[model samples]
Each structure stands twice: as C-alpha cells, then as structure tokens.
Target: MTSFKIPSAPRSIQKDNPIKFLLDSETIDCLAHNIALVHPVFDAQAFKRLALTNIAPLGIMDRSAHIAAALKATLPAKFSEAADILLQTLTPPNVHTDRLGLSVFFYLPHTRFIADYGRDAQHNSGEDPFDVAMRAQYELTRRFTAEFSIRPFLTHDFERTLNQLQQWLNDPDPHVRRLCSEGSRPRLPWGARIPQLIADPSPVLPILEALKNDPSLYVRRSVANHLGDIAKDHSTLAFEVCERWLTDADKDLKWVIRHAVRHPAKQGNATALAIRKAAGGR
Candidate 1:
C-alpha cells in the first residue's frame, strides 16, 4: 500500500503569519460558499463582513479570538441555533483526507467559536454541558480538530469529562480516538494547562492504556504526547509507564513508549535510560 503524504503549510504561511493563512480572503470565500449551501437564510456577504472587520490590526491569537466573537455576534443569537448552523456547514469528512488540508484551515475558526461559546455557557450555568460540547466537537474534529476546544471541559469537570473521553476510545473515527488523549494532555501546546493532571496524571492512565497501541499513528502520537505532558511534572510515573509498556513491545508500541519518556531520557533519568536501553536505543 502506498501512503499519501500531506503537504506542510505553505512557506508563506509559515514565515509570514499563521493567522493570515487561516482567515485570509480566500478562506473566507470558501467558508461563505459552503455555509450558503447548508443555510439558505445565511447572508454570506454579511457574515464575511463581520468576520473580516478590523481583522487586520490583530496578531495570530487575537485574530482567532476576534473571529470567534464575530461569529457569535453575526450568527443566530440562540446558542443551539448558531451551533446547528455551523455544524451543518461543515465540509464532509471524506473531502479532506489530509490532516492539514485547506478545508481544515477553513473550518478551524468555526470550531473555535463553538468551543468558546460552550465553555462560557458551562462556566456560567454551573452545569455540565459535556454532551452538547462533546457532540459538536466530535463532528467538528472530523473536519479540522477540537483538541484545543475540549480543554475547558477537562479543566472544569475532570472526572465527568474523562469518563466521556474514555467512551471515545472505541469510536470508529481515528480523530475521535486521538481526541481522547490530545484533549486530556496536561501541557498541550497552545492550550490551557490542566493543573490536576500535571500534579497527578494517574487519572489518565486508563485512557493511555487503551490507546497505547492504536491502529492510527495519529492516535498513537497523541498518547505519546499525553505521556510526555505527564512526565513534565511526574517523571517517575511517566518512567514507570514506559518501563511497563516497553517489555516485548513492537516497533510501533516502542515508538509510543520512547515518546512518552523523551524528556526524562534527555535528563539521564535512570528508568528512562533503562527503558531506552531495553528498546536498544532505537
């Protein structure tokens, strides 16, 4: 079987500005076109105007924030109504097999908007909006990703949110399975740190156990990253997990274990060193 390599972000995007790549005029036009297909009542021109207004002065993060706020303001006032509109507008999952395809970039802002709205509502209402948020995230991830979006739930309601993530372990879609680990990482980049997990990552062991040998490399990579996050604060725990999983492991599983202990291995931690030795320093 031949694998298709997904191209990296354009050099212009990488060197100039990531925000421009995401919210550029071309992306907005694609978004408008797709949205109009699902929503006859949608005002594409108005939506574009709102999203692009004053967007020039902002930096990368601020641009994303501005777009989220703009989405909420222009779309239906009702949360459910607005969420439904966005969900319907999502491009088909099969349309973009490449993880970093243009379609994913186009949908990124919309996913973030859903996440921000859900998080605010959950925080203010003091209610677990896990179901609603998870459902939206599950769908949104198929198009782009909800990794950063799901962090609020994990922060506010760790146990409940974790239980929901555990259920996602069996999801047929590799993205959903990946989310189980990625969304729960203690130190995910560009995401809020989860103090509880950083202090004691034992709660997430079950999740890691389930995905340690995931068929999808995408999912397995997340498991490794989640473990690496754990190692930052709990090196012993990370080392122990790696040691246990290293014995009689295959190449793929060993890759995961190595990634899990990368930080500790660099620092000459005994157990990390031993695990690397066991894997023959591959």
Candidate 2:
C-alpha cells in the first residue's frame, strides 16, 4: 500500500457499491501514504483511525463525507493551508484518458473535502475561501471530476459560480471544459440539482453553446447532455438552440445536436426527428 495506487478493477463490492472499496482499510492506508508524501503536517495514523471509524454502515457518498470529515479534523484548521496540502497531494491530471473507470474515485474524498469545507470563511480568516475552493476544484476536476463538489459553490453563489464556469469553457483540459457544462447541468445524475438552473436554464445555455463543437468528444458529450437537461424543462429553447447550431453544423456539431434531441426523436416529436434527420444521426 506504500505505492498509493488504486486497483484497476474493484477489489470488492458490497451490494454492488463499486465505490465501497474506496473506504476500505487498504485504500485508507494508501491514501495516507500519498497524502503524507506531500503534506508534512498530515497525521497519517490519526487520519486512518478517523477515516475508518464507523465506515461500514455507509454507502459511497456517505463514505466520502466521512473521509472528508476526517481530513478536516486532522488537517490544518486554516482552510487555505489545508486546501493547498490536498491540492499538492493530487496525482497528475488524467487527460486524454476516457472511461477512466472507478479508480478515479480515489479522489472522491478529496472532492468531498472541498464540498464540506469550501465555504468556511471563519477558517479562512478574511481570505475569500471561494477563490481557493475554485482553485482546488479546478485541479480536482482534471484528475477526478468536481461536478458534485461544485454544487455547494453554485448554491452559495450563483452568479459568481456561473461566471467562473463560463470562463472555464476555453480551458486547455477537456475535463475542465466538460465540467463547465456538466457541473451546471440542471439534473446531472448523482449531482445535487442546481435549483436556479432547474428553474430556468437560460444561464447555462451559453456554456453549452460555447462547447457545442469542442475538439474533445468528452466535452461535447457533456454539452449535449446539459442541452438534454434543458430540453426536459425548456423544450422550446432546447429545440431552438439545436436548430441554430444546425445552420452550418459540421459533423461534430451535428453529433452534439443529435444527442441533445435523442429522447424527443425517439418519441416521434416532429421537430426533434427533423433535427435528427438534419444531423444525420441515423
């Protein structure tokens, strides 16, 4: 476990919770090894003792929350310092590697650490904790998606969050760009729904539009799914957006438009089918 590597395949399962093993004793030991490598102050024994305590009854997210709590309890009380330690502990960003599988969940506790503590101003002692939070998430997304961790930030600051996400559309990493769209998704599965986005998805449309033809399908697919979420609530707007993109759509853009309208097309919605036909998704 000194090597601090995640198994390519899950080591075990409890009721098919593939992520359950992330909280296992071995993983905790390895995580401690990795964290201790970079953070001189991290108390490995204390972290392991706390992380493993009362973990058996929990499911995946609960496990993540539990581990995050342990980190906060053991790491520095100063938010900025603790965030830096965790950020420094990250593995290299996993770019250009699709279907990275469950192993990336190795960072699940890292993301949970931010989500649980990202907005703590008292601990920040006058520093804007949000800025550091955003930085941590940016780094986290490249290695392990920050989509779920970002929701608390969106809830805490809608305009600021959207503005930051908007700015990330042009990021060099496809993972970061994909997060711009995926993180704001109205009904992103497993992610807490952003009520503002769900109530009126207009704010997120610009992000989708910007990434509609992203060079990485990893990013384009997120844009399409975000569009599909918009369609679930704002069908007309989604349809209009798809139609506009189709005006001179290249194959990539066409693929995006087609994916966005797939459900409606399946149900024989005329406009959806027409758009699908134009995109040549058949």
Q: After superposition, how far is residue 91 of candidate 2 from its true place, in Å?
A: 1.2
lDDT of 2 by residue, 55-158 (tens): 99898889989998998898888888989988877778895647576678878888998988888688777677999999999999999899999998898788
Model 2, runs deviating above 4 Å: 1-17
> Which portions of model 1 miss their true places by more than 4 Å?
1-13, 17-19, 94-99, 120-129
Task: Please report, in order, the local distance difference test score of every candidate based on alpha carbons.
Answer: 0.75, 0.86
- Winning model by TM-score: 2
Q: Roughly what TM-score does model 1 have, to 2 decimal places?
A: 0.86
TM match of model 2 to true structure? 0.92
